[model samples]
Target: MSEVPLPYRVTRVRPETADTVSVALAPAGEESLAPFMPGQFAMVYAFGVGEIPVSVSGIGDHELEHTVRSVGAVSAALCALRPGGRIGLRGPFGTGWELGRAAGRDLLVVAGGIGLAPLRPLVTAALAAPHAYGRLNLLVGARTPDDLPYAGQVHAWSASHGPPYCQVTVDRPAPAWRGRVGVVTTLLNGAAFAPGNTTAFVCGPEVMIRVTARELVHRGLAPHRIRVSLERNMRCATGHCGHCQLGGVLLCRDGPVIGWDRAESLLSAREL
Candidate 1:
């Protein structure tokens, strides 16, 4: 991973929602960093604006994709970029989903809002090698129908009538919305899995991760079998910055992805 960001040219930008855009990038020069795994992230620099850790939403040959939500200045700059726009990127940083460990076991993916971005590549890999794993299940939640990204693709996965039995729920519904409505955990009751032989990957708001992990454990899934992605306050991708520290763990290096067993107590403790 190069600490000095490499120039990446935006090849395409597709608006996913009112305030979010999916930007596809390719190396602007012969220098490419490294291949990014499913759960890893990159520090995207928007020139004079700043940089932020954004998980790789999609990975392809000599290309990278980021689903940026325009909630702050840096992210807004990324969202505003059009085709041919240039930005700086560094990494293939942090732990990945490590799907190999789950070989021959059922797979469960739970994502909330933008959290789906990080988990998308994992789902795609599982789908690509369906026979390598047992069953694939996906549960997603968003604030509203409009707030959900990858609406078309998600439904397409669900419509496949094969592995990755997908279900989506929303906190609130729009006038024409006709899907289930509630928190993401609500879909857990209907997800197909053999708790003992299943491995789950979850990402979202911390609260959603907590409740979802708890529910999975309650249904007999081992805490260690449940992995979660925590963004925290990762300013520096390297561990030197204490901004992303959670208890004894530095999310930037130690995680962004970690086992629920390691996170349960830390999350329950009150932060001073």
Candidate 2:
């Protein structure tokens, strides 16, 4: 098969939270853009710095956006690029959290810190087809209330009793904050989930994923039903580079998203 070409041009770049910025890009011309499943990510390349994989944060009319936090050299460079700057993009890759499987069932999304990026596309997709799913619960956690993403949108989602049930938590609460306080896991206690019919998607730091996954399982979610998005050092979006190999799995190619059962080995393996 021929290689898929990168066809994105920066349309707008705006900050979403303290450390994260949202970038919107559209197709360069008449060429059509590839459709992506929620929870999939695109590999973004900055000419001189390098290429890094980032999740699609929002999809707009004629554009797709990515939420990126300044975490490393390449990311800092991405944050520095102005609107209209040229950047390379290569995906919508990885096995996404399958929305089809959750159809007619409840959907639970748990995100911590920057982990919210990958979950955004899934939320959008779910909301678009509200009738297909039973209930949609989104629980997000951040270092502080100010670090939350899509604050206004999340609030509106929560107000509705249907699919998009949104809730937020913070490690430390400001005086004005009235939402749940403590880790994201703490909020799970009172939430109602139909374990047998519900599928949960989690993305966060390793420790947070571990703790959250444990809680989900304890709440009766099947180990295999829990999907998680994993992060590692990636140099090439293709599997040629060895930078992102964890155990026998190549994160860039095999996943960024994997089922809990499949990831169990690596999650417990040493130096993965």
Candidate 3:
């Protein structure tokens, strides 16, 4: 992961929600950074504005995608970018979801709101190779129907008729919404998987991750088989900055994705 950002041009810009946009980028010059893994993040520089760590939502040959929510200055700048715009990008940083470990085991994916962005590629990979894994289940939740990103893509995934078994819920429902309504964990009751044979991937608010992982453990899944993605005030993608430290681990360098066996105590610390 180079500290310096490389020039990239926006190839496509699509609005996902009122405050979110998915931007596709390609190398502007000959040089191209190494491919990013599913759960890894890139430091995206919006010209004079500044840079922020954005997870890679999709990855292809010499191409990348980022789903940005307009939460702050840097994110808002990214959301406003147009198709022909230019930006700077660096990295393939931090640990990835490591899907290979789950081979031959059932796959469970849980996401809350924008957390789905980083896990998107993992789901796509699993779907494409149905024979490589056991049953696949995806549970997603958002504040409201409109708050959900990749709504159409998720709908298509669920409509595919089998295997993936996608389900969605909303904390607050709109008048036109007709799906389930509740926190993400509420949907787990219907997910089909044998606890002993399952490997789960979870990403969301810290509280949601904690609750989901604990529930899975209570239902007989081993803590070591559950993986979670975490985020903090990560200023530098390298370990030099202590901003993203949780307990003794630096999220940007050592994590962002870790097994529940290792993350449980760190997340439960009273003075992290």
Candidate 4:
């Protein structure tokens, strides 16, 4: 398919957190947007304005979804549009969190704030095929209770079966909230997994990814077994633009989903 943006009609919009909204899209064609793997992102365009890369927040047997935050001119424009609006989309780009590596092994997923959007599909896919992986875990953290995205779903996952064993934390908690309080890394202390057999997937702020990966390593997960979705780096969702370049890595092509061993040096030296 062409990297040029494809026309997509907004089918529905649902506010996630205060600043985030989940928009469902359907391409203006018989082909529709291509099926995307978890952790892959699409370059979403708001007509008349520019475009930005947004992660796929939710996906199932039907709708294509994007959980976008109105943080900039183009993104805000994309968010303000209503359900009947039209947008442009390209990609399903970047390397996705290849969950097959974790098959028959422990899988740990960690997210921070909106970072959970890209990781949600991984969770849904894992749950649908429970016997494929040894254990499933999800840990998420946000600035505050009100900042947590997908709150209801998180609650459901936490209350579900043995694997997935979900845990959520907030930097600060509202008096009305009764969940754990602290940065996401704090939850790692109570995480139950044999580090040696664990394949960990982390997506969050640069600092959080570092801290969490270090914690996972301290507990025994090998660097190669750790996968991370880098911040949605892009200009051209295809690698030609170089705007999202990090030394030898072109985030749009080489990653977005990069192994800790492959990215540790770059994440350490640069402003990823």
TM-score ranking of the models: 1, 3, 4, 2
The C-alpha lDDT values of all candidates are 0.92, 0.82, 0.91, 0.86
* Model 2: per-residue Cα lDDT over 109-183, one tens digit each: 999988988899888899889889877888989898888877777767767774677878899999998878899
lDDT tens readout by residue for model 3, 1-272: 47899999999998988999999999999998898889999989998898888889999887899999999998999999999899999898999999988999999999999999999989988888999999999999999999999999887766776668899999999999989999999999989999999999999888899999999999999998999999888777888978889987889988989999999999887668
Off by over 4 Å in 4: 270-272
lDDT of 1 by residue, 1-272 (tens): 55689999999999988998999999999989889999999999999999999999999987899999999999999999999999999898999999999999999999999999999999989989989999899999999999898989987876777577999899999999888999999998888899999999999999999999999999999999999999877777998879998898898898989999999998999881
Deviation in Å, model 1, residue 121 alpha carbon: 0.5
Candidate 4: worst-modelled 10 consecutive residues by lDDT: 231-240
TM per model?
0.98, 0.93, 0.97, 0.96
State the displacement of the C-alpha of residue 174, model 2, in Å, after optimal TM-score superposition: 1.7
For model 3, the run of ten residues with the poorest summed lDDT: 155-164
Worst 10 residues of 2 by lDDT: 1-10
Please write out the lDDT profile of model 4 over residues 1-272, one tens digit for every residue: 54678888889998888888889988767666678999888899888889898889877655689988889999899779788899988877888899987889988999999889999999988988999998788999999988888888897777776567999999988999888989998888777888888999999988999888888888888998999988644788777877888778888888889999888888888655
Off by over 4 Å in 2: 1-7, 159-162
Candidate 4 clashing pairs?
A: 136-164
Candidate 1 residue 252 C-alpha distance from true site, Å: 0.9
Greater-TM-score candidate between 2 and 3: 3
Ordering by lDDT:
1, 3, 4, 2
Q: Candidate 1: worst 10 consecutive residues by lDDT?
A: 155-164
RMSD of every prediction: 1.0, 1.9, 1.1, 1.4
